[model samples]
Target chain A: MRGSKAVVGVYSYLDDLLKGIADIRSADLDYKVYSPAYRHEIEEATLPGKSSVRRFTLTGGIIGCTFGWTLAILCSLDWPLRVSAKDIVSPPGFFVIGYECTILFGALATLGSLLLYCGLPNFLRKVGYDPRFSRDKFGLVVGCDGHNLEDVKGRLMKSGADEVNVTEGI
Target chain B: MSKQSEKKEVSYAMVNDLVLRMLEPPGAGWWVLLLTCITLLSWGAVSFAYQLWAGYGMAGNAHPIGWGTYITNFVFWVGIAHSGTLISAVLYLFRAKFRMPIYRLAEAMTVFAVMTAGLFPLIHVGRPWMALWLMPYPNERALWPNFRSPLLWDVFAVSTYFTVSAVFFFVGLVPDIAAARDRAKTFFRKMLYGVASLGWTGNNTQWKHFIAAYLLFAGLATPLVVSVHSVVSWDFAMSIVPGWHATIFPPYFVAGAIFSGVAMVMTLIIPLRKVFKLEPLIREEHFDAMSKLILLTSSIVAYAYITEFYVAWYSNNMFERFQFWFRPFGEFAVAFWGMAFCNCIAPLALWYGPLRRNIAFLFVLSIIINIGMWLERFNIIFTSLAREYIPAAWGSYNFSWVEIGITFGAFGWFGMWMTLFIKFFPAVAITEIKEILPPPVRNKESLQGHH
Candidate 1:
């Protein structure tokens, strides 16, 4: 992966980092933020749209419930036992299996969506990632062509970035 | 870059260092604990092998008391598993910030306890190879497991619980694993942490999806906390046996489960906090909050007991009344009273602030509660079955050496897994603690409009 962005600013304080990102945003410079922790401020600033993971959860739950009911009812019909003079299609017993499957499938779907949305299991590490981004430092990777590289770096530095490193790609 | 004019009191850098330090290789004491657990676990494996060779007859189970110590231990461990989901998932949904430090351990306990609990039914069945028949797969024999049986429901419930809990535990560990990956000093360590972390970058987009998925899991697991134990309870309640067939069993079992589970967590965290020196993260305030939860659950369990006895008397059923009466005054009366005293009377100590805060007192009390909870299952299973409808078929069961060894082995199994987990994974949620800490103050001029 070639890094097109030149400036990577690390900040000790989240507010300073957010301010720096906001200043860069004003210049319409494309950037991505990284933090050691999940900060609501960062999410609100960078990715404000609603997540789509819940749709997968709902779809998975529906399929699970239907499958559970179908399996129970079909298995009983196949056996065709007249135990205790009760109906072969026992809704009560089927509901238990269905309830469990709903949770099982819903949880699995959530995991699937998490992996898909997060772009995980990428054996190859992305380029231009700072090690300290996973520790205390919050990093803002700004994308800039050579014409605006110095301009973006100066803005982040003036916005109180602890360190500003100019990388070639991203 | 120029340094800030004033020094920041605390920084995320310090938090990362303290939390990640726990993931280092074990000390001498941890190794000793692991070896002891492994030895005990090996003894348990030997006992299981013997049981396999000797058949179910080797267990103390007999005609009337068909279910014995194995089932008792099964129920106890299942109950012990509940508090983890309760603390991790349920408490998370409720927005309990205090759960941050200890929830990971509780979730780990849930997974391990369920794994241990899964072994019991197979062990109890004697024919371990035939246990595969419990699965719902299509077979050439044209036979299906009895869906009407709560036992079958248990097969589904417990397995689902294990899967969900394990996934939840791993999902929560991702950021921590990434943190570990960054700090890895060796190539082997980096590669291991790298795979475990799955290339987590902690970017804004990933956090958005991560939080969403995590919340969904919390929501999914919360129902499981209620349904799994309720299903376990139905294994008894759905039966025709006196003292077992009660509508109240679901809530009763659920409360008892949380009661025992919380005690187990206390038992674990007290020793862990001391050994790991995690006082700042797992403070006295956390214990105070947890003890109060224990008190609440204990009271519920106590109320369930009284209501159970009252219902037995009011029903005017001779068998039910006898079963209830026999519990406190019959052959298992000692166990019955011990259970009541330990589960109901012992947790009352937490109501006092001094006792709740007293580490030694709480630790001992937690152990006592575990014992009581175990006895509670024993009394419930044995007394009712021994003196059932047929007096001629009445019999008593003694815990044979096999069952005793297996029980000890289960503990060893749980302990060994946990010992390794603490050494490898972040014992506490490092990413979460960073979020919980107040962010550093910034200059008003630079941050004025953003806030």
Candidate 2:
């Protein structure tokens, strides 16, 4: 397991590193990119698409609206107590509750979907992580066979990686 | 690649060093402050316990003036909570780059202030255990909280605001927590950071989802910044009380909330930046920008004050007119005049550029405005209820020592939480600042030379 994956490149500048990723993409090497901050360059180079998180927000809002209206209406109907001659089920008043629920559920759903998508709360520490990536440095973990380890290391070094770490056996 | 700005260069290591330094153990001075807050908080707890034992009569509540200092404190703290969302969500949506350094503290303040505000209603209700009745959960009684009631609306609005804001705050912390985790030397610190970080790897995939989720939350929270305070306003406006029942309550409350919120932010951050040596990160420009907002909102609040009186006179409603007149010349004249001076007049100083830039002036002004905002609430609650429609029911209410102690305790509680938060978590958003920074200087030469 330890002899499988090969090199990790720590780049100080995001632009050069992103270009390095573009080069890796052209070569079709399996790789992971890490940065301290979210960068559009990385997004364009790597995960290029509209995030699917929006669907969760939309669906959650719909569910929330339905839940809000249904709950308010059902509760009113259950009691059937007419207050101040108003109707039992007041849609106008319930709209406030519905609006609040929409935001509440939508935010919750967004957070839930985010955690699900990111595979977060993972207690186990995965290998091939460089501590410097959490600081100023950008990191690339390129998966390589024994034969391509040297080639991958050289490619990352040539692309202006400040330092490259070689790890063996996954 | 986007062209880098030729601004003062900041490296990621510099940010890490500056922010993570806050996570170090507190000094003797910090311990002294924490101890004082804890002492005050304990006194507040004792006061509350006494209230629980002695009953609501311990506070100043009688015939016409059923609502008193408790309600005033509730509204004040809620108003204080509003600025955080405005700075964090509204400013974020507008792409205010300066919000990066200070928004984290403001957001934390919002959460803690709301927590303090939430306690008031529970205490006001007297039977704290039965306060859960405000919730719409299914029960054997087959009764639901009255949705038509503004108080019930407040229940949903405030709770929703709290939940969303807390989640938003924590979401922003994920990356910073990971940074802290990597830098942790002690095993205990490492374990704590590791769990809190939620296995954040800062990979492109995580960043993508994080940003998307953050944007959605910001959008969701933006409306809440308006709605929460609006619903809180309706608690007064929906009533038939003269000063309380105004059509202008919603926007007026929103503006005042933001006004007081910014003032409170200034109150907290002025000292914090000095203590943490975050002057570089939280620049003078940020203070200038915030002061401008404070000025804008204060003007709106001042306008609301005038409009309230104008509408009262224009309507030719005797009670409304009397209420407005009574505010300035009546029993609570001192409070009304003080509020006007502090809220309306004091903020006028910011009109001068030098005053806004002067940290001493801004700090003093912020304290004065906070006092003015509190008085504003006090005047509204006390004056309106004291002299309502029925003359026979007219009564004056005074603050009992118990209520005063409890209010002080709320402040202590809020301060204590914030002090602890600053110690454990990065008060500033590390990742956000990194995003806005010019590309690292050392890295730039190496990369450009290669190209």
Whose DockQ is greatest here?
1
Off by over 4 Å in 2: A1-3, B1-7, B441-451
Score each candidate by Cα lDDT: 0.88, 0.89
> Tens digits of per-residue lDDT for model 1 on A13-88?
8888888878988887778888889888888888888899999999999998998888888899898887787788
User: Which pairs of residues collide in model 1?
Assistant: A3-A169, A3-A170, A4-A169, A4-A170, A5-A169
Which candidate achieves the best lDDT against the true structure? 2
Q: Candidate 2 - CAPRI tier? A: medium
Please give the lDDT score for candidate 1: 0.88
Residue-level lDDT tens digits of model 1 in B1-451: 2223212333677777877888776689998999999999998999999988888787888878888888998999999999999999999989998898899899999999998988898899899799999987899999877787799999989999999999999999999999999998878888889999999988888899999899999999999999999999999999889999999999999999999999999999899988877776777778888899999999999999999999999999999999998999998899999999999988887888988778888899999999999999998899989989877877887778988899999999999998888888887888887877766547556445545
- The lDDT of model 2 is 0.89
lDDT of 1 at B100: 88
For candidate 1, the docking band is: medium
Write model 2 residue lDDT over B250-295, tens digit each, in one string.
9999999999999999999999899999877887778899999999
What is each candidate's DockQ, to 2 decimals? 0.72, 0.64
lDDT of 1 at A144: 79
